[model samples]
Target: MSAAAPTSGPATGLLAVGAYAPPNVVTNAHYAARLDTSDEWIVSRTGIRERRHAAAGETSSALGAHAVRDLLTRHPDALEGVSAVICATSSPDAMFPSTAALIAGEVGLRGAAAFDVSVACSGFLYALAVGHSLIAAGLAGRVLVVGTEVMSGTVDQEDRNTAILFGDGAGAAVLGPVPAGYGFQSFVLGADSSGGPHLYLRGSALRLPAGTEMGPYLTQNGREVFKFAVRTLGDSAEQAMREAGMSTAQIDWLVPHQANRRIIDAACERFGLPLERAVVNLDRYGNTSAASIPLALDEAVKAGRFKDGDQLLLAGFGGGLSWGAAALRWWGGAG
Candidate 1:
């Protein structure tokens, strides 16, 4: 079914993007030395050769702030009339004083409304939709959407299943009103709590099932998650495209969640999109949860891969068993 055309209102556009990754690089050899794995094995399985690790005392806010700072430096006008900051993160600095608040304070946006969205890797897209709606609703003229994750602290180093699959990074984008028919067109979002058991990080305050115990580290059933992701990626993207009145031939790029290479390849094949037209960076950053999409987006934008008026389809799935997709045109006629 096609998405209903949105009511006339301010059209939200992605003005600029930026990202940051810690300097400390953790290669496969580091894991191989401890776990029974090798560079070839890790690459073959996850397509990751190395990933960034936050240094001692670094926090998600710090990384996010850095990314925002980078964006501001490149496009100083991006924050003009900005009134809110929405941060998407699964690994937040604290339960209270949301990471968005911390990042806002770091970037000198003290009076802006600040909050956090915790939906694992799909969070950036969720937060983006919220930012877009806020602009359309006239509540905010512009919003800063940041996705940051410090997964190094969340993963159990001893667990080969997850340790080798995550990294730490942040990406930020400024969303503001663009010309008519020039920005975000439609979004498709969904969730299934039943898949929660397949991927989760137990929190101290969360109630557990009868025999379940709280665990601090991130946990996952890789096989189950892999199965869910491949299907959801293609399904979500297709749904978003349909809603946006776009077809596979009209899409210029597919910026998917940087989870697994195999999942991405399978999803592309199923969606009938060529692998070459997809933006992928998992080989270097691994899976940065909420940070993956924005990080890939920022990199691609900087590389001049996405031209004005390019039709882009973004899709992601993660821990909440949540999946989301957005169909948007690259920076177009409007400012």
Candidate 2:
């Protein structure tokens, strides 16, 4: 988790979202022959390629700072009224001090409340909700909510199962206040700790004493996690739309977690959303854990896939078997 500043409700929030993928790219072929896999196997299964890895000294917080750097450049004014910073991530440079703290220093934001969120893949959404609520509740003005991950550090490079599906990256969104019906309208968050084992890392200090290999690696059951992702993510999205008094017809975009192309397709099928309405970057970045959504959002905006006041449904599913969804009005943005 990272440390950031505190916020106190702002008017018309979420002024911008920015993303950054490290310059380095590791193609499937780069990992295939060395391991017991092939390029074909990698692409057919995970739709990944050339995922970006951090340079020698790069860390999750560092990459997140890069994203914030670009964000501030494009939206220099978004931080003007910001009151806090919230970073969503499962991995941090160090266990303490919070990655948000380092990122805050990088971005020159020292007055807001800062903290890190550790909700696995749903971390970004968790952070986004917090920022949005703080503004909507008058608790914080504008908030810097970011999701970043350097999964390359956790994936056993030799383990084809996990190594082939992760990449390092960061994405951020600055949330402020907006007129009623102009910002986030409805959101659904749920967790089933029982499914924790299906996707957890053993030997972590957080759950044990005298940590030696705490989270040095990740353990997961792909099949089970995929099933949960498909069903729960779809259900949560639909539930959010309904709660917001909306239907699929009103949704202009579905920015989903870039964990799997298949799971995303399934969710869209269940929601009756056209395939063209989505913005998929899995082929380029793999699963960036919490950073997936922000990365996708940044790309979509850059690619000119949205417009002012467009309806968007953001959803995610991940470890903890947790899932969440939020309905938003993609009001304005140049990038």
Candidate 3:
């Protein structure tokens, strides 16, 4: 199935991109020193050697704000007409007052329409779709979509299952008008709530009984998640590509969520795309949840990898058993 033709509306696209990882680095050896795992075991499983950790008192908002600041620093006029700030984060600083609002305030966008999306690792793509729609509907001209995570705060340091696979980072993209036919072409989003039990963070929010006990940490059934992610990611990519009226051969880059090396390889193989056509950085940053795609995109852009008019496929899946994908024609220039 091919995607519907581009709709007639305000042409919207990513204008710029930026990312930030805290200075603190945690190597596999850091975990090996405490856990029963070694560097070879961690790398062979997750393809991660080192990951960043947020410093003391650092929050998702702070990490996201840093990314926005970086974007603004390079593209000083990025916020000239930005009227909305949407942050996708599962590790929010607090339950109230959205992390987007905090980031907007920090970036001097005090009165912008700001909010948060809690779709886990698929969040950035979700926020990107929302930002794209906002522009298409003329609700906002320029919107900042950020995916920030302090996963280090959520993972149990003692739980090797999760602790070894997550890192803290933030990535932001400024969405605005681009030349016609040069932005987002189509999007696909889906979820299977039954898979929710495979990954979750059980906390006191559910209001347990007086004596009920809960583990206040991110937990997961790795085998279940691996199975679900591999299938959903490939399907989501095909759906998004079809919706964009393109075939796998037309895709110039595949930017999947940086969850695991095996999952990424499987998805690429399913698409019949070579590994070289995919943007991957999980080896250095592990899984930064929603930040993965944009972080990799930013790195690729700065490295002069994407050319103008490149067809890019962005896909992700995460904790809510949610997955999303988008097809876009890149115009380059984003850093």
**Per-residue accuracy of model 3 over 220-251 as CA lDDT, tens digit each:** 88999999889889888988887777788788
lDDT of 1: 0.88
CA RMSD, predictions in order: 2.0, 4.3, 2.7
lDDT of each: 0.88, 0.82, 0.88
Between candidates 1 and 2, the one scoring higher on TM-score is 1
Name the runs in model 1 displaced over 4 angstroms.
Answer: 1-8, 209-213, 332-335
How does each model score on TM-score? 0.96, 0.92, 0.95
**Lowest summed lDDT window (length 10), candidate 3:** 1-10
Tens-digit lDDT string for candidate 2 (223-251)? 98988888888888888888778787788
| RMSD value for candidate 1 | 2.0
List where candidate 2 sits over 4 angstroms from the true fold: 1-13, 206-215, 333-335
Which scores higher on lDDT, 1 or 2?
A: 1
Ranking by TM-score: 1, 3, 2
